[model samples]
Target: MISRIAETGHAVGTAVGYRNLSKKGQRTVKAGLLLSPVLLWLVLYKYLALGYNVYLSFSEMSYTGEFSFVGLANWQQLANDPVFFQSLFNTVVLFATIPVSIAIALGIAILLNQQFPGNNAFRSLFFLPYITMMVAIAVIWQYMFKTDGGVINYFLLQLGVIESNISWFGDSTWALVAIFAIQVWKTVGFYIVILLAGLQTIPEQVYQVAKIDGATRLQRFLYLTLPLLKSTIGVCMLVGIVISFRLFDLILVLTNGGPGNGTEILLTWIYKQAFLHGNFGYAAALSVVMIALAVVVALIGRNLQRSSHL
Candidate 1:
């Protein structure tokens, strides 16, 4: 009888262990199933494309879609291309609006943070541009910037700001500026939204303490708000750099990199080279340069932020 009881107990133990092992195997399979799609997408779409682009940059891609490795010939050509330097300079100059946009956004955020009538309405209005269609915005601005019978030029003429209607997109001096202004107009709202959210995260108690110490509003803002908002500002600045540096659509719609390439940016130049000029290898090299610029901008922003914090 004791032998029989021991045999039954061993059988129960073995069955329980097998059941647990089966459950573990099922969980492992489930996890793999969930992650497989995302891993496959990243590998094929992102990593594979990036590798192919690098390969193309080193090869001569012909109009017939044939390619052969030319051992840095594309890179050498890119180095000597005058348009590349002009586009790089324009790319750098476009970044000038980032600080201006952030500053304006921060100001608006501060104003919106105050207790006032129609505060939510104001916020929604400011953020409307960000949610609106980019193409629609561009079209509306294009009309407004028309050389004749345009609302903007009409107002300028009315105010004696200019002698006559000026072609905002035709002239080299104003073409880049017009694009810059449109970029700021479209993007300022996004930064404002980010900053407003950050501002709300600050504890009211901090302000209360400062008030108790009899600090003036400007003094409190300078001493506390700016310092505390550094992280948020840093994030906005980095993102703004990336967005403004890769500016293409606005220039495409407004100027098409025209007025003698006055408003040409890196991406637009790359588009022109790849599609119009049928120089895919050169475009790939330009893309590599763009990636390098982005990395350098990110690094420089980080270092500047660290130094400021220290």
Candidate 2:
């Protein structure tokens, strides 16, 4: 009787273990089912598109959609192209706005962090440019910067800042300057919002303790606040780099890369090559180079952030 009872108990224990395993297997199937759509989308859209672009960089594609593999010819042409280098240089020049934007945004964010009247309203006002349609911004700024009857030129003439109306979009040098100004104006609000979020993450108690320890405002800001916010600043710089590199619509609408390709950037150049000139392979090579540069910069930024934390 004791032997029989032990066998039955063992069978019951085995069945229970099997049921637990079956339930776990079902849960795993459910999880996989939930994730399958996202995985499929990435596979179809992101990875496949990226792979096709890479392949296209090595192959020549005619305006008639005929594809012929011509390895290294497009890349060789890109290396010898002066316009490519010019566009690259123009793109690099826009990077200057990143530091300026960061500095202005940091100051504004700090000021807004302090308790004051209408602080939220001010933030919303500043952020308006970021959300505003780029086409509208381009149209408005293009009109404002006009040499004749333009609001900016009109004001400058009235204030005796210039002897005559400046050719903002007409002159190459001044056109780049105008683009820089617009870029900074449009991006500063975004940086301010990001920095404000980072600032809030810092504890009030820490600031109070620093005060008790006789830390001056500047000292606390430099040593405590900056160090704590290093990660956030790194993130902003990375984002700024990407934004500066991807600049296309504003340049396209505002200047159309006119006055002699002065405001032309990598993207605009690529667009012209692919659509206007029908040099799709060369354009693909240019795109690949741009992607590589972006990846390298992002890696460097990540390393710097990691080092700062260390």
Candidate 3:
């Protein structure tokens, strides 16, 4: 009887343990069901594709599209390419607009923050360009900057600024300036909206207290508004940097990186390499370089933001 009782107790303990494990298993299965789709998506679309691209960067493909390892040949070619260097230079020039854009946007944001009749309408008007189609904008700007019978040239000629129609897109020296004008025009609205949101987040009571203290407009802006908006400004700066690097459509549609490759940039060059020249491996290498540069810019921006806190 004692042996039989001991055996029964062991059996009960096993049943209890199995019941506990069953409950735990059910919970785990529910969690897996919830997370599996997201995991599958990332693994299939994002992680696997990134890995494949990296592999392609180091390998060359035959006409049959069979990839074979080419070691550092692509990188060596990229390093020696003169057009690559010119593209890099143009990218830097485009990036120079970031601070300028931010400054102008800050001013616009401040103006929009004030109360006025039809304020919302004016705000939308300023922000319209950012949401407009780039292809359409590029085509419009091409006509606006045309060499002969262009509206811009007509105005300049009327003002006695130049003797003849200036080839804005066809001249190497002026091509980038035209690009800068369009870029600033299209992007300023976005920064303004972001900054205006930031401005609205600042407490009205803080500004009221400044006004009560007899602070002048400039002093209040310098001491209160600018200091409080530092984080927002930093974010805008980072966004601007990324946009400058990703500037393909505007360059492609506007100049096609023309005027003797005057406006060539990283993305434009990568597109040309991958699609036009069938240099997939080289283009992949360029893409990696572009990603690295963007990462470096992000790190630098983060460091600056952190240091500002100190």
Query: Which should have the higher lDDT, number 2 or number 3?
Result: 2
Best by lDDT: 2
lDDT of each: 0.84, 0.87, 0.86
TM-score of each: 0.82, 0.85, 0.83
| Model 2 C-alpha lDDT per residue in residues 182-282, reported as the tens digit of each score | 99999999999999998999999989999999999999999888888787787888998867753588999898997888788888999999999999999
Q: Please, what are the lDDT tens digits per residue for candidate 1 over residues 151-213? A: 999999999999988988888778878878888898899899888988998899999999999
Highest TM-score scorer: 2
- lDDT of candidate 2 at residue 47, scale 0 to 100: 88
lDDT of 3 by residue, 198-253 (tens): 89989999889999999999999999888778778878878887667536888889
> Which stretches of model 2 miss by more than 4 angstroms?
1-33, 158-161, 304-310
